[model samples]
Target: VLTTFDLDEYVHAALRAGASGFLLKDARPDELLAGIRAVAGGDAVIAPALTRRLLDEFARYGSAPTDDPRVDRLTEREREILVAIGRGWTNGEIAARLVLSESTVKTHVGRVLAKTGARDRVQAVIFAYDLGLARPSVR
Candidate 1:
């Protein structure tokens, strides 16, 4: 987890560096605690507002999604899980929605990250968007 106000540039850098959560310094006590717990539980966390802003910024500079050979390595199930991750769904949410066990979802998520060369869940989410597997709706 990273507690910093440098969201503009460092957020992406931190995630790429394998940091699981990014929380602003001004986060409330409850939010900070939750972020830490989420990270400790092997889950990724980012403030919702920051997520939206980051997605919008990325979308502006994003390249047109094309056929990337890396994505071809994923199985159909892995691809689906990657898209779900890109949609900001938790492992529990994915498990419930896909009618699978949480452990199964975790396995698939790990596989997706491995196959795609993503360092973490955030990187996987970025990969999903970059590959056109998922599109972020900036609203």
Candidate 2:
């Protein structure tokens, strides 16, 4: 997905619709190529500048989705992993913060995605936001 619109809803919808990457129209040519390669290699990407903006928008105004029966399957650890993912935390960050090994964090992340029916980490981020499980803290 490449567009001039940086609205959070579009970003969320694109990821939810299973877009492998989203880049702004103004992105550098090299960045665009890199994003294409990343997506082709089975990784997901989002425009760097939009990451924080997306998080802030979700924290401020995202609405809850309809009840998800699968959510009942998450363990407490997996729930925490979802929130960390929603805050845009990397796997290493989640491991460190949760005092778990990186492999353990990975497993928990996998469970969270499976339970939530999210196709990828980006989708899981949207799930967390929609469930009101994640929010920005005042600094």
Each prediction's TM-score versus the true structure: 0.81, 0.81
Query: What lDDT does candidate 1 reach at residue 77?
Result: 89
Candidates in order have lDDT scores of: 0.82, 0.83
RMSD in Å for model 1: 2.4
lDDT for model 1, please: 0.82
Off by over 4 Å in 2: 4-9, 64-67
Top of the candidates by TM-score: 2
Question: Which candidate wins on lDDT?
Answer: 2
What is the overall TM-score of model 2 with all chains considered together? 0.81
What digit string (tens of lDDT, one per residue) describes model 1 on residues 36-135?
Answer: 8877876778877688778886777766788987788989888899999988889999999999999999999989888988877888888877776777
Look at candidate 2 and tell me the lDDT of residue 115. 83
